[model samples]
Target: MTDPTGVTITERHEQDGIVMEILEWSRLGGMTDPAGLPLLALMRTAELPVRQLRLTLTDAAVVLEAGALQAWHGRIEVENTIPAGRLLRRMVGSALSGERLFRPRYSGTGVVLTEPLLQCLLPVGLQDETVIVDQGLFLACSGGIEVGAAVQRTGSALLFGGEGLVQTRLSGTGFAVLQSPVPDSELIKVTLKKGETMAVDGPFAVLRSGSVRFSVGKSAKTWFGTAVSGEGLMQILEGPGDVWLSPLQPVYDGFAALARTLGPDATEAAESGRRR
Candidate 1:
């Protein structure tokens, strides 16, 4: 469906869950000003992942993390979801979540298309539920959902286990979309009963937000045992809900492996180089 213009959005590969938004080549006016010819040629074969979400005016408001918006049709009012008083906290939370500090809020009826991304998009429905996401995994969520930081049980836990000192936490009744490098097929799901616990080796956890308590603790009974066992500090998930684990996160895999290969000092320098 074209959005009242030459831009046509359609689900060309519905079975693969891919929606294609094609901007008619004939409508490319100044688009040919620079390297337009080659760009137009490349656009023909490019199978992009465009997400289309329909909005209802009086229903739930759609909230997109900063810059997630690509195009939209209908009357949608834009605003910042962050409260004026909680700006500082939000900033800190953003730093920990490895996401942009400001998220844009859109409300009213309309259809919005998100820009194509390399990662797969996951649509999650929550009814008074909670989910903890990996750092940088969040894309957008419903305005009724609460966004904040999910902190580790302790500082030591934070350093050895998680992506960082904090991760993104979503709660309340609504739907959410997360970007994950791992496909849904490979993401293994394990449900834990009350008083049950599981230990993970690395940052294999994708999400364990449903009635799950995540922490970092000794791999064994004693410090000597842990050190000799080469287990170090491990992520211990205690639960009564679900846990999703991915084999890898391509975004963080290289860097994390490099950090492990090098010592602590070299890892810091490597991180600094990455920042630069």
Candidate 2:
């Protein structure tokens, strides 16, 4: 939908290397509620080309993944939350892997902006809850919560498979926001009862935490058995918790499918490089 101005504020534009959309509406008109509360909500501006996700905060705090603030207005307080001597080790692990250990805490009475890639925001509700997130995926969460330590797995297959070594975990009683690759409509939430087990052949898992046991192991006991199983390395999740997965498979799936679509020329070139 167009902006309320009848002019062109909601339109998307590319400046320098960044793509941006200027939003305008009644909410953006400095309108406040009866108690003087800001109308905070996530607004979807356009469906394609430039899909937008807007979040407004009313007198709250958000822990942003460091350096993610795009723009903001009104009463905003920004501060760097440095870890003390007790938590230095855990914080250092995240910093080594391209993620900021000590992220900036955003709290105030105004609105904050984010995004250069136009990704959708996934708000995760936490009640002493914990979410193990891929590095750099941490967006913003309520001030009541805390960003916990990093998670690591030393499996040889997991590293070479591109899952990486470090992931951030947020835990507390509030809502944590994450930058979602798939939109909320496309995210599939699967609830597994206690003692139940499920395995995914791909890294489709977005978030898996809370009483769930997660590991990367062989698809089968034997090499020949794995071949018959038609699965190589697998992400195993044992529950009593929720798992969010994407239908698009994983990151590699996109490249593989695109290569197939571009036909034999692309496939042959990739195969030739692999041989070399």
Candidate 3:
């Protein structure tokens, strides 16, 4: 598909990187709950080098476009029982925007854009020897990563294994895009309070928020294993894959569930109902 500017947008997924043009058809008020509102609808109308993007929807669309530091296009997939709303909230958090910039999250798979964003207040990168900790599961990536902190191990293997949390103090100013066990955009940034510990899935799960003191801890109970704590901002995300939002899976499953519950002709019915 092509946009009014003649930019051809197509859907695809590759191990490398892809560029495309995206046209958002709606705006979401800064509402945490993403239900009872219209879905964020768009078609792959065009593909371009995507030198720069402009979000025309209401609220802070333009801010998001400008604030976005990096953008990459690719395919994504998810298969889990997580709620769609929770997953989408995590993606919006990934963009470091409180506004509703994405739709509900779901399981399945598809293509989408993956981005790494930072808060305007923090430095562009982590300080030398600064440790970034992962409190949930270990993520494996082939990309070379600057070691921020020395690696450490805990007594309980489950609490510190690849399925648990990993911690590393920062050594210098740089960023590491560690792979996630789940496809999501939310990167939680939190400060650790004295004696405070946070258990979460990964560092990418909490993209960019204010900093506090934090450390990795174990599950409070059986199911509720790890979580992040402290008085600062902490991000949470959900979707497909291990890292980044699996566009195909989340978007496809979200809409599919909506369609099934509302009926196959829901989108059309929505238009008709709006007209009435």
How does residue 161 of candidate 3 score in lDDT?
36
> Which ranges of candidate 3 are over 4 A from the true structure?
1-124, 133-152, 155-171, 175-189, 197-276
**At residue 132, what lDDT does model 2 achieve?**
79
How many clashes in each candidate?
0, 0, 60
Model 1 clash pairs are none
Candidate 1 error regions (>4 Å): 3-60, 91-99, 248-276
lDDT of 2: 0.63
TM-scores, all candidates, are 0.69, 0.69, 0.27
Q: Name model 2 segments beyond 4 Å from true.
A: 1-58, 154-162, 227-230, 250-276
Ten contiguous residues with the weakest lDDT in model 3: 54-63
Encode model 3's per-residue lDDT on 74-178: one tens digit a residue.
Answer: 232222222576666545543542322322221112222323211111112333323344432212111112322222243443343342333432233333233
CA lDDT, candidate 2, residue 103: 79
Best by lDDT: 1
